[model samples]
Target: MLAALPVAVLLFDDEGLAYANPEARRVVELDATAASSPPHVEAPAVVDAVNRARRTGQAIDCELERDGRQWQVSASPTACGQVGVVITDLTEVRRTDTIRRDFVLNASHELKTPVASIQALADSLRLATERDPARAASMLESLEREAARMSQLVRDLLDLVRLEERTGEEEPAEADLAELVRTQTTRVAQAAAEQGMDLRVDVPDVARVAGSPGDVRIVVANLVDNAVAYNRHGGTVTARVRRAGDEVVLEVSDTGIGISPEDQQRVFERFYRVDPHRSRRAGGTGLGLALVRHAVRRLSGELQLDSTLGQGTTLTVRLPPAPTSVAAPAQPPPP
Candidate 1:
């Protein structure tokens, strides 16, 4: 790949810049006569890596700073008494990795609580058999409740994992978007009814998308379910589907306490909730938006949200249109 041009490069020795590739000079923020200048440390991790690569012949690889943005830095010893450094923008990868790691750890920690509680209660019940049947029954009831909580947690974990895997498969299909929204709206209507909330649907007759029906249903259900579950005591949940040019848009809007601007970015994170106490009381897994994001990415679509604190939130999903060619029928052989 010598033919493949890079974005930036830098050469440093003795903790000072020696030479730099044109792209590297512009990107790494180096000026004229930088060879005599110091190599600025953007991150401690990267500085450590550089020190390690200097002490040893190993390469230093880490995220560094350039123009206040994160970039991947790779430093290695060169043949001519110089250190070769390569910088690549890794903001997206770093962000995705951070979210993924948080998801795994949070899911484990959340699921472990109920399981550990149940285990403790069971042990107590076993040892307290001769103490009092009433107390033993109470422990048994707590155990059952924790057991159910554990079951729900486990189900949500599995659902998150399944969605995580399937949503990256890039499977696309032709289907009616309006019908999918209507179906999901009908399904969640009963759940909304439990809270005495009104659920309505406004679907265009022929909105279509180029995505798997199962995945589309998932996106619809999660959005609608969140709207209903997080809504006020007597709120309204609306599911609307339409098309704008070549994009099919599905929106789920609710009259609930909306999200704040600061927390809006974190809402799509797995196991993240603006109000943890209320989320737990409402029995949410906090993986809804995360799943929706993955589904949208796999479907080659875009998912956007608009919300105002104390007003409401709207989730808008736009899916690309499917191609309109049917497979040719099998032709009979001519005798």
Candidate 2:
């Protein structure tokens, strides 16, 4: 029945309102008895759409905001000199569209920076080749760096898309948390050493988790890389994994520049940098923390950050432990 339909529907003719479903009445907050007379709805946008449909003998659609809600109002003319109106709630859909638009704009802006730098450097190099050999070599180095940065950015964006697609739909397998942490720490230890920072890693002897090994490896690598990359020279970077009751915890701490309370809240956002220039100088793509956060989420994990702006920052991650049948008894890893 039209009256029982979920969508708001109204039928009107040259005389007045011929019929209005219950939903239509509720949407515009009109009384059922008012159906005999044309409602005095003062929304010019919807009214104009209906009038346009009647005058042109064609369908018209418009979106409008009223009473703190967004709506899509459509008017379709009928053969018998009548118009049928349909209103759909567009609040959530519009919000999603806005977010998507913003993301694309931000990503474009981010991509543009390195590309512009590369182009400028290339032009300079071309001119320097005929004028100054030293200048040309310097320009070539700069161009290489910009190209690498752009490559990293594209890779991280793709990784983010894949991770987002897997959120809440992960298929986990039995993985050794201890081995993952230990191996990742080894991979980044050289970088930390080169920066004159200490890399200390501690893992349990045989802590097992249920997660995609590749995804979990990525999470460990990103966090450790961020710790070393953001840390100050002669500082300390520590990574550890331990069992906390039913949960497994992975923590990465850095004795480098800490994040302010304000920036801490947004650190997980894609392409967010506390110090854009400094992060860029450190060869960071600004997507590391975002990737880490999303990957952890896919594994059903919680991440926490603790920091004092001038002291250091620590990121703590907790994940649901593998089933008892899969996990081995926990013990501290070798020193």
Model 1: residues with Cα > 4 Å off, grouped in runs:
1-19, 31-66, 69-97, 120-172, 204-208, 322-335
Assess every candidate by TM-score: 0.69, 0.76
Per-residue lDDT tens digits of candidate 2, residues 164-198?
A: 88635545486787888889889887878888998
Q: Going through the candidates in order, what is the number of backbone clashes in each?
A: 3, 0
lDDT of 2: 0.84
TM-score of 1: 0.69
Tens digit of lDDT per residue, candidate 1, span 19-118?
5666665665556464455656345554576577878988878876756678888988877767777778887778889977876798888888788898
Candidate with maximal TM-score: 2
lDDT of 1 at 309: 95
